[model samples]
Target: MLPCRNRTGKMRLGASIESRPAEVETRKTFGHWEIDTVIGKKKGKNAVVLTLVERNTDFYITRKIPAKAASAVNSEIKQLFSDFGKKPEKIFMTLTADRGLEFASLAELENESTKIYFAHPYSSYEREINERHNRILRRFIPKGTDINKISEEELERIEDLINGLPRKRLGYKTPEELFNEQLDLIYRL
Candidate 1:
């Protein structure tokens, strides 16, 4: 992977994660998310998985893309946000991602109520929640496995299994429970 600077010359498009608001760090807000792409084995025209995890609730979302191109990834991101309905900004307040070229167009996601932040180079820990979720996904879809062979139903099952598992950090509640609670709050607001 080339350095993010190599792709954009001098100017980086988004704010650094270090500049992210304190509320985001505390994970008290429901809208902040960390995004990443999980690629299948290196092969001709291999498909990839686009993953997003809500910071506060650890809610995970994934979509399969034809490839790891930035355009495909951006399109999936747009579609995901569009699924949130009229005011996507209300549900997608902030997105933090690494400097992957696949996320190069992430700035297009920013709006009046939403912002995008890029983690510093070589700092995967900054997106810890996302990384952890990806690791769990690997249990079902091992590395080097062809993503093209995985059906949507299988992916949904994997997602459900991960979200349904209770977590001690979340007071033993499943991510699905907390995520649903947050969504209810958002709707009630």
Candidate 2:
């Protein structure tokens, strides 16, 4: 992928296939997060859903936002974390996002503890967790359907189903299991 050229000639930082390749080595960090947006419907009329997955625990969070505009995405992210109760150190330690303008203001997400990184555009393999999570989400909310119509209660149910699925990646453990384990570990400390 080329440097994201917004309407202006300025080079925007987004996932560029050439820049971010597959992981050279997988690290065992717990708080590293993979972030991406799922766009539904046609170009003109669409709802964007932001999805995040924790690399170590396979925990996930999904939030439906108004559009893919950077401002909305950023605001939704803030809201999601706030809804989860922001203890920045315990929540997100680092974030990896694709080359979408929606993530351009990643610095705002950074606390002294949380770092933000970017994946090369079109490099789906880099954010593999988000990629697979999106596929699972598609089972309930197919592509080309307006996410706006989906109520929060329904979305929570979808999230519950996704979290409750037995994941081969986790040795047949459900994401909820791994997520709770990690949370328990943190509390025990």
Candidate 3:
């Protein structure tokens, strides 16, 4: 866990991304993920998008939330895990995220197998895959666009476009291809 100073000048505790195993960095494992939020220009009541990307397969999961509040983010994530059914741990072994207030309650996501890690302050590179995905999303949603105006179908289309794109890192295979391959392996195991 890393030591961080809260608004009241008190130290808050959270696990650091550095503590993650080396296998996560090598992208040899399928369950490790990186998470982040994409917010609309109007901060107060505008909606936000919660994004999670698989480290190895580059699979993307993006959800639109009402706001960036910890409760909203946590609830959505919990529902996501629930949708994964009885063995969410097999699909989400670890999550690395930024130290944003919206993710303050991330510890609640932990289970017997799943763990959460926070990147160092001001260090977005720690969650590079998430950051890159967010950038691509911005091309469709763009900065300052009201997320509230976007529909779920529109978001899915954007996600599909991204997943369908080939990546040199994946030897020119699309993210959808690799993600499905990993899912097949997980099911078999």
In model 1, pairs of residues that clash are none
- List TM-scores for all candidates, in order: 0.92, 0.82, 0.92
lDDT of each: 0.89, 0.76, 0.88
Error of 1 at 104 (Å): 0.6
Residues 114-157 of candidate 2 have per-residue lDDT tens digits of 66777765788877878988999998889888888888788888
Ranking by TM-score: 1, 3, 2
Best by lDDT: 1
lDDT by residue (tens digit), candidate 1, 6-82: 55565475899988898999998789999999988997998999999999889999889999988998899889878
Tell me how far the alpha carbon of residue 111 in candidate 2 is from the true structure, in angstroms, after superposition.
2.4
Shift of residue 67 alpha carbon in model 2, Å: 1.3
lDDT of 3 by residue, 139-164 (tens): 99889999999999999999999999
- Identify the runs in model 2 with alpha carbons over 4 angstroms from their true place: 1-27, 43-45
